[model samples]
Target: MDADKMSDLHEEGKNAINAPMLPIGTDIHPEDTLLEENAERIMLDPTSRENLKFKDLLKVLIDWINSELEEERIIVKDLEEDCYDGQVLQKLFEKLSGRKLNVAEVTQSEIGQKQKLQTVLEAVNELLRPHGWTIEWSVDSIHSKNLVAIVYLLVALAMHFQAPIRLPEHVSVQVVVVKKREGILQTALVTKELTSTTEMMLGRFERDAFDTLLDHAPDKLNVVKTSLITFVNKHLNKLNLEVTELESQFADGVYLVLLMGLLEDYFVPLYNFFLTPENFEQKVHNVAFAFELMQDGGLKKPKARPEDVVNLNLKSTLRVLYNLFTNYKNSE
Candidate 1:
């Protein structure tokens, strides 16, 4: 091979070697993670702990939100419990899910509807505060079809994109959209087969706000939004990074590290819940739901090759993510 190709190979080998395998079920803490050491990276805390138990911690917190939603639903007329349609919200609760919260905000305001909002904000802020994250939510009247609640993730702690190729600053993911129309209130979480599938094979539609957070990714040109495939391809082109190369970089790379860190942190409280047989059964249920839809003429039979599996894996990952909170039987 040419010298240039050889040089590329060497670098790839180095990244592969240096990539960190962050353990699952680790909490995000300022002292526990690279958030302290590297002002430049939104780093991972690699310390492992034993004897962690879930005991339905996630189910409880989720129940709180679900109860709130159930109460509100009687009142957003536009909001429907459509499993395959409606807008997909960002992974706020997932990233925030399964954590311990201080209920101090529960007492902040005793006034009517404001009290419920305060309860959620206080509960979330308390949990995130220690990790250098300040959570904020607002009532959005014009951003969507209904009056919505928008959650903003502010970086209070020193965090960076994953190392090896770290982003200069951390990206704040906007999450947890609550919509109310007429008198009814509902959560917008599900992605659909028709509108949500952006590319025939790439990614799904998250919000354009996510693009603004990434430095190298383009400023979404038109106010008009596009599909996930379009978004991923456009950003990937600008960054000049192939999905395979980025995938191989894994937890060490900037985007994947931050993304995975958030995911793992989100899973901390639900650790045991995942180990439960019900989780897999739910996944299988989700798969069967998906398979039933595939009976349509749109999807072709996939070639059952290892490479094909890889491609399918990428899409499936994105698809699952799109469905993560929205399709959860509990979060409903």
Candidate 2:
């Protein structure tokens, strides 16, 4: 009977191999996932600093995010449900990093929310990477409303941005991570720390050479910008794009994104971004997305904030262009 079942399975596989191809644009829905939920059972003592760590840090992070996004009127009551849709995160990042993200303001669908989460998290990781901070959460974990993971990310962001909130030093929380698989269930006790500001040792580096040159030497700055402009136009001409006003032109992030694709020999998907930004928010979002792409291509993350470039800040814009120029000056 086992041999007969094997033969039947082989025939079914053969039939599947010979099945007709589906037409383009067909909607292929995927099966539901196993709901990857890692439940965290907090073991708090309420008296010990280690025990009070999670509660103290959670309140600090929530307050910091609320204050940062007060103008947007986004109050993050719980990191789980409030952040699952990505709107709050997007706004928080814009306020922290001073850059708007090119994601939907409101995503109702699971896939849409996940996509936005991926973008926001990638940008967050890029910002944190230069500081030697490691990312502790994934899109799935955050989307699934894992409280522990959410708290970890918020703590990291708060510390990285130096949010004006009082977080206890050496805060640790004992938690049991519960997982079930293949009809088996298991739990592991983990001690997680709400890392303090001192533990990070994130020191700010000196301003970029371009920024310094523009400050002390205006004539030389013009010469350098002109040289970079010529280099930019040489390639941009291929796509009929020009950079007559480097400060104002690249502020929108459209030209910068296109220029990066041209020099790096990659395609910036149109659907992935807005081609014609309608407002200041969209412009900043485009610039931020460009910066992410630059980091993805192994380029050093620029020090300039996305909003700075969008606002036509000469030092910030020059810093970004100068970095690209130094890297791809000799490239075809």
Candidate 3:
């Protein structure tokens, strides 16, 4: 564990776990005499503290899920027990009264999982309330943008450079995320990294940048839209997920993990374009470079040593991307 506190001493300030505790002198000490209304003061690393809280919340949720699964097993057992000699019992009940006893039955439901998650999210929000960060859960707001943004990015930069107008069928149904916020949005690069946003001024910057790009590529903008439609359709065919494009049906952490992993796998450079304004043009060039290197077969050989895809083999990169997304889907 990282040191939560430091004290100037001859030896050292031990971590929070090993902090000095008063010696036990009595069966019931003053500290344990009654409920102490006063809050305890302690040092903490902000990043570690947040991470622990997130883990704690998630652990509780996982435990609850396990309990639910156990309850499901119990339900199945009860069903079996109740149905043991079911025909004999049915006859007995039928003979006992004109109206037969109504059998109590229960079946497992996915709704329980959704309710558990909602309750868990609320608990997480409560835990975060003390902190400045406000947790926000949106269904498909950012999820829809995962791969579709690639086409927009390609179109945005295509005005000045040659970007592939046609991507493979696999590009059609990219893994979409169920975007949530533990804090607030910045450049959207580091999700939930910014906790002190009083307003969405940065969001305006995002809009302006997108508007500027679209304005610059007025003629190709509509073509880009058409291309995005085709791309999304192809992506749907590519992925095995049952969810639709705009549906926020899946509100799960798997989506978040997969989305982050996909961005890391597919093209980190493309994501970096929105992160740095000063280096935006170069980043765009770098993004366009990889797509340019890609051909009908897969990622093509680099044109020159300076090429972005020069050192990276196209086939390996695509395989890793496909495999990672596939694994995430299978995990679900």
Ranking by TM-score: 2, 1, 3
lDDT-best of 1 and 2: 2
Residue pairs with clashing backbones, model 2: none
lDDT, candidates in the order shown: 0.28, 0.73, 0.29
lDDT tens digits, residue span 1-332, model 3 = 33443222312332222333322321222332222333221111233324543334333323322333352442222211222322222322233223343432322343433343333334433533464333333112112122122222222222112121211121111121222122211111112221112113123223332244444767764454344334333433334533332112112212222243243345334443233323434533543433333331253432222222222433222222333343333332
Query: Residue-wise lDDT of candidate 1 within 188-257, one digit each (tens)?
Result: 2221111112121112222323334332444542221234333333334443643433222221223322
Q: List the residue pairs that clash in candidate 1.
A: 41-159, 41-160, 42-159, 42-160, 75-183, 75-184, 76-184, 76-185
What are the per-residue Cα lDDT tens digits for candidate 2 across 66-116?
867888887888877898777888888888898888898788999999999
Displacement of the residue 202 alpha carbon in candidate 2, Å: 5.7
Candidate 1 global TM-score: 0.21
Query: What value does the lDDT take at residue 146 in candidate 3?
Result: 20
Model 3 / residue 328 / CA error / Å: 18
Off by over 4 Å in 1: 1-110, 138-311, 315-332
Residue 273 lDDT in model 1? 22
